[model samples]
Target: MTSLPEDPSSPIGESARDTAVRRLQEAFSEGHISHEELDGRLHWALTAKTHGELVAALAALPAEKAGTTSTIAAAGGQIRRRGAWQVPRTLKVASAFGRVRLDLSRAVIEHPVIDIELQLGTGRAHITVPRDAIVDLEGLHTGWKDLRYKTRRSSRPGGPTIRISGMVGFGRLKVRHARR
Candidate 1:
């Protein structure tokens, strides 16, 4: 652990803690640790008061593997990806004047967190996430129509988090969780 101030709320310390927490979640999703272990490590990482404690929470975990991003775009037509497709760690979807549909109910997801950047200019974008997944839209910007998302209290809490970002100009973005 790099020597730093002992305050956990400091800028550097907070960033380090966030990274450690993400790594722990990734390790859990990658099957490197059990759910119980993940819970314990996550607690340690979240409540760490010092950089040394933060580093200890990530002990024995290997560095995160680098992954490529996949992009699907359409200038004036529709874009769709369904069935048992393989999901990359990062994805970019853009549509200029048509519909966009992404169904991830049966996709092969290996990452603990997936980042999807959507750029839709004048159409609707629909996303069907897995039942246990968490969707984050904090970075998304919309216009004219509000985003549609139905939140549920998931029984299983350790699934991958799907983060949707980017902008949607003059269109609607609908997001729903899978039934199964």
Candidate 2:
């Protein structure tokens, strides 16, 4: 068992703490821990004093395995990934003067989290996920672009997490909620 710091007030740098939180989120998204378990550990991690304390929060989770990726090119009219098709752990979407849409409300997903890379130029991308799923748009670059989503819904734990990246220029990217 990892021991707590001798001094609780000792500063645990924000970067280190952020890394720990990311690790915890990864574990949660990989189905290694339940939402309740993640919530409990997240509280502990947030109040931790040392790196060891943060590491302990993820020590009990299962190890992750390799995942597959899928790429969708939208140079044509439109690209859609809806219905009963399988969903990859990572998705790459590239659109140039076209439209790309991914509806995950009814898609088959094996993983608890998905990583997406988008490249849009004079094009548009639309994504719809289940209401419970969390959408992380932190890595997206919206310079000279338009990004929109449903702000009325609140994301809850236990559902899949979608971490999005990439950039858009003279294009639009939007996210929405869907029920299936």
Candidate 3:
């Protein structure tokens, strides 16, 4: 095993601390830890001066699941997911003549990359992702209208990536980054 540097101010120590913090965030998003516990552990992880202290901040967390998939389908009604909802690793959405809205600005996203597959028969589908999120719409096919998405520079490096795929027949797909 590679030994981490003792001084937290060192580059190696900072990198180790960052990794620990990401793990803690993932644990919280996976429901392995409460918000309070995550906050406490994050404090320790950021302030730790030694490798042992950093390890202690990540103690007892359950192993991350390999991957989880969730499906949402609607025949004639709207499908919406917003506000602090837990985002799985893979999501499948199917709708027919119904609007689909996914607001992920305030969502709890654990995985570094999330895949969303959409199969819409008709109607418009809108998605609002986090400001730092990177979106890929290359795999999406629209029949009637063009996909509405404006590309911009990501504010933060190593942020979550949202990969959207599948087909939309006679419907429009609009994707935008969150303002707040």
Model 1, stretches more than 4 Å misplaced? 1-64
lDDT of all the models against the reference? 0.87, 0.78, 0.86
What does candidate 1's lDDT look like per residue over 14-85, in tens digits?
Answer: 767777877787788678999999999999989887766776788899776765489998898899999999
Residue-level error in angstroms, candidate 3, position 24: 23
What is candidate 1's TM-score against the reference? Answer: 0.67
For all predictions, the C-alpha RMSD in Å is 5.7, 6.6, 11.6
Between candidates 1 and 3, which one is better according to lDDT?
Answer: 1
The regions of model 2 sitting more than 4 angstroms off are 1-28, 31-67
lDDT of 3 at 50: 75
Residues 1-180 of candidate 2 have per-residue lDDT tens digits of 123345645556777677667767777766677899889988988988766676676677655454567888867688878888888888898988888888988888778888889888887888998778888899999968569976535567677888889998788899987754
> Per-residue CA lDDT of candidate 3, range 1-180, in tens?
135766644444566777788678777755689999999999998888777777678889876465578999999889999999999998999999999999999999988778899999878899999999989888988898899999866578766889999999998999999999
